[model samples]
Target: MNLLKKRWLLLTAACVINLCAGSIYAWSVFAPPLAERLSLITGTAVTAGSLAAAFSLANGIAPIPMILGGWINDRFGPRAIIPAGGIVMGLGFYLAATAVTPLELILGYGLGFGLGLGLVYGSSVNTTLKFFPDHRGLAGGIATAVYGLSSVILPPVAHALIETEGIEAALLTLGGVFAIVIVAGGLLLEKCPDAFAKQFTAAAPGKQMAAEECDWRGMLRSTRFPPMVALMLCGAIPGMMIISHCWSLAKDVVGLDAAAASAMVSMLALANVFGRLLVGALSDKFGRLASLSGALILTILATVLLSLSDQNAHLLFSAGILAIGLSFGAFMGIYPGFTAEEFGAKNNSVNYGIMFSGFSVAGFAGPMAMNMLKEAGMSYQTICLLAGTLAILGLGFAYLFVRAKKAAYS
Candidate 1:
């Protein structure tokens, strides 16, 4: 049909491809089983805690490949880059299936899978943002919401597969499926036309203003970049901290049982998905900065609620968890469109990838801070209060970001 019709098809493909690539979030399902298999094979004690370094590597190394993938996607279009990424991801799983040592697992799943994930994830998001300039927030929200939802949806299926087929066979099966879906989806995508925005403007008389194009180098040099990164980091820290330790918080601090603690995890994931969808649409109408400010407020309030919550106050604890999930999801949803709006979409793939480095930093800092403080005999209440203080500082940074954006763009 027409190019317009083709874009919708491409959007569908991107969603499907993202669904597969997002399975990386379900790494928790594989961790214990994989660790056990490694222990048996290597005749050494391989705890899940020991295997966590590989998981950390998988997340920590993604930004490097994302930048590289974004560069390729910007130049050559997503069609080739996406399939290539899928192939590498599949190869990683294949290698992981044969791993006899922790190093091999790290190389295969950590480095290899992480590299492929960065490529595919960046391509899908960039492509979606390019095609839907008129609906960037909603488009990005849907893309990331599905990505976040993978952890919720895949865990049960992955657990079942591991139980029946064994970890190696399950890895092989899932890897093959992920590759086929991503490759097929990639084939359906095409680059956005140069005049696409002009066409939208012509069709809709009162649409948002056309974005000002800025290359990656110019974007990095801009006055707005630093504050924007700082705002993102601040917004992300509480979410990362809560997500990494929610189960422990639920169990040890809130005194939740096994089933209830598991439910808290599911609730957080669901809230995350809802937040991505809701804040994304709302930001389109309410403005990104305002929506972000609201999210930060919610984060601060959540932290306070959590700090005050105890075993006798399950409702308060649940509310705190829900709020953190929503606020965190809002940050994830807002940033893609916000980056494009601030720096422009022409170089968005690379620019957003660079912007995402803030998230990587938050990922490490949030969890490490929580773990260290807890190890040093700090109370959960004290930790939550500290997180709240960080959110307050983030709110200040958000104001700085707004000011910087206006000064630069105006």
Candidate 2:
């Protein structure tokens, strides 16, 4: 195939792999069911928070494997590692299906799923970035957008499986299908050609790129890195919180039934997908910092509105979902491109892996905070208010980064 065709194929394959890998996001659907099942089997009450630990722990554990996957992919191609990720992910779901204890659930879903996710996610995203250097934001967005889209497509099926066949069957079925699809995509995946890789070094006229061929260590040494990490952490917490706990919130706060809760999850995913695509394209047209600033501002507003919504105010709640989801997806869409712009695309796999550790931290911290605060007698609105505050904190970092960008380009 020609270069353009090959790149497009690779992008398509990456998207497919990500779609399968992102089954982890459907944890909201599984959390209540899994908790109920465990409670029934063990004859003890189980909290969604306890089960959510698996999800939080999964995100926490992912950073180590993410760094490993990136380093390996930097040296070797993605074919082997990506396929291995699929196998590992399948094994995780299989384990979850048979799990009767909380520990087993944690090991299966937390370590197994998290490790597999880390392995595949960075490789897929970096591969796309390498392929479309000129449109890094759009390319990265397209890849991650599919990951977000998984939430849109999978929750209803998962809900149906849990309702009809039970959670075990749901886990087993999803696992099997994901493994096959991811493996196929991994096999079909390709790195950018040498010609395309070379073009990445060539910048548009009068556009001064700050970082060029900068290694991870050098990138870390720069002042910009710290603020970026802070921005990512703060920006991600609210979204991760919502994603991990949305079902519970819908049931408890919105007083929605199972079907409605499932619908809420789908709505969140739809908004997320829209944001991913829109934010990436907007960043390409505008600037990454500008796009991030706008998203963060939106997050702050949406979070407050969500906090204020009562059970009767479903429309207000849905609006909050859409707004928060949009900001969440926007962050994911823009950050890969931002990493490449600031750190340098030459070492992007490793650099982004390191930068992504912030997200990993946020992912875990968000869920942990929610569950912990809930246990401590915090209201849902109180938690959301905290989340909104964090978004405000993120905006501060966004401003700093924008200033830094101006100084670099000036």
Candidate 3:
């Protein structure tokens, strides 16, 4: 179907697959059903936060396979694996749907599904970058933006499936649908048109033109990396906390019941989509550090709102979430864009594969941080306050980076 001819179709597929691959954010939606089915609770048999932790761990660890996936793509091409990921991801969901116990949920959805997600997720960026090499940021922005949009699309559907058919049936049906998608979408990923790769690599000027040429060895040696990892961790905490505590906050802080709380989660998901795209494209205009700074400031404000109110919390929460989500989106967009801008995309998959584990690291850290805080008798208010403060600290780091950038030029 001449996918390149219909660029829109390709974009749609990319967006769909990307977003769907990211539905890991929607893990919270399953917690209620999963918990109910197993008769567990937050501090009891199971914690939604812990499950989220597991998912983040998987996502962080995803880059490992992505590194391998990129190598495979560079060799055999992308077609077969992407779709296989989709199928496996679906099966993960299916496992979640069918799970009667925690073990199945962890192994099936967390491990198996996560592996599929990792495989396709990184490839999507690599694929989109190749497709629109000229607009790498835009491609990465939109495709990467799906990180949050995944939550927007699936959690509600998952919520409904849980509410309607029960988790088991939902798992079965969704898995079946995914099996078909994997087979179909995987086919399109088969080959990178030689013209595209050739034209792309040829367009670069010197060992200096595009920031995409480097051996994996050089990439591993860069000392400029730690700050980037720090930026990602700082950005991830509150955003993840919001995700982990979506329902709980809506219930406790906002005074919403289950249905209403879920609805708010949906709203957060919607905002997340907007945030990812907006922050990313904005980076192209304003520069990466500025975008990061803006997001950090916004995160601080959002956390403030999050710390305030009960039933009257909705409006403030909305404002705070917008900032938090956008900051998060920016983080996703900026990291890949920054990596490519700094090191070049030649070893992008490999470098990012290693670096990308930060997400999982954040995922692991985020929940543990929050849970520890909570267990230490820290209120959500305390956690929100600290997370927001960290955002400010991140802003300082971004400021320093910008200063360094300016210094290099002068």
Candidate 4:
């Protein structure tokens, strides 16, 4: 009863942090205001706020905190880290509501808010993965998938809050939301008991060891780690292109109406959530290596089809969403399971952070490079084709990794 109670609490907290991260997927909602703030008026084809730039930067650069957060959790445990992360993150939102200038908003949302996110998100997968190692893939996927849904819900709610209550009130309201998530969930998030671990990981067992187990530098230098990180980077590389350009591509090439274009984005997120849960569960049954490799192959096909989707009705829409969602959710689904399987749970929190930077690298490059490439006369289709090529290459890497792992174990 006591351990179950603790898990309920911590899972609640993990869900909260995951939701905040997913809320980033709602960057489109803020683009208009941010654009206006940055002198990129809505009427202008390109907005000045560079919403994509700021969002990607904040999300990418922000992963730094995950390293520290994971380290803290490993040393002292989630009890100290999560609540502290929540308190700090809550304050960032309180300040964000008051932001007026572009620089101010960047600091508020980009740096400060980003920091809070980094702190909480750092531990989300690590903590939850420990709780349900049998379901690490599922557990981590569901935690991240909440953010997918967060994008769905927060945008409309945020709009309502901003319209009725005003931006300041909206900020304050969201701060409260973050506070609820942090406190309610934070209090809930505690270390899993050995019994819980036993029940969860009956088949794929875990070891109870010191909080500090792996050296990040040592992990970095190891041959085993880099391939996994590279696989993630390859899987994630084209995500920015799809999300940032989905609407424009739909309108410009596919000739979809505005309503259709909007629906497509929503469906994409919905598919992503589905992929996360389904893939994660399958990984638990099959193996992380198998599940992730299949996802990569699927992603490669979808990206290629999406690139040339000039007027395939919903095909472009369907393909693009599936690809983005798979790639987006795959990391969350795969990383925790992979790390736990390979490194032992004791070191998972810290080592995963170092590996997680592959995501940050994708975040930084995906948006800017996609846009820059398109502007430089590269067709979105052609670029997507290139992404497909990379995806195939990623699948090859995954194959090598799996083969090598088998050789080692056998």
Model 1, residue 320: distance off in Å is 0.8
Across 335-403, the per-residue lDDT of candidate 1 in tens digits comes to 988888777777889999999888999999999999999999999888998998888998888888768
Residue by residue across 148-255, what tens digits does model 2's lDDT show?
Answer: 898777777789989999989999999999999888888888755545655444354212243566788888877788889889888899888887798898899889
The model with the greater TM-score, 3 or 4, is 4
Off by over 4 Å in 2: 28-51, 159-170, 200-210, 241-262, 307-315, 368-386, 403-410
Error of 4 at 335 (Å): 1.5
C-alpha-based local distance difference test score of model 1: 0.86
Best-performing candidate as measured by lDDT: 1
Which 10 consecutive residues of model 4 have the lowest summed lDDT? 204-213
How many clashes show up per model? Answer: 0, 0, 8, 7
Q: What is the lDDT of residue 207 in candidate 4?
A: 24
Residue lDDT tens for model 3, 216-294: 5766655456566677778877687776677787787777889988787767766667776777776665666667778
Question: Which residues of candidate 1, in runs, are more than 4 Å off?
Answer: 202-207
What digit string (tens of lDDT, one per residue) describes model 4 on residues 1-410?
A: 66645655666668777786566655566657555534532244446455455565568666788888888887677777777777766776665556555556666676666776777776776888777655677776777667667878888877777679766677677777876677566666776554555554246322222222347775665556667887887777766557667777777768889998888877777777777877877777677777777788877778867866777656765776677777667666667667766766766777887777787778667777788888899887788888778778888788777675566446
Top TM-score model: 1
The lDDT per prediction is 0.86, 0.84, 0.68, 0.70
Q: What TM-score would you give candidate 1 relative to the actual structure?
A: 0.96
Best first by lDDT, ranked: 1, 2, 4, 3
TM per candidate: 0.96, 0.86, 0.81, 0.88
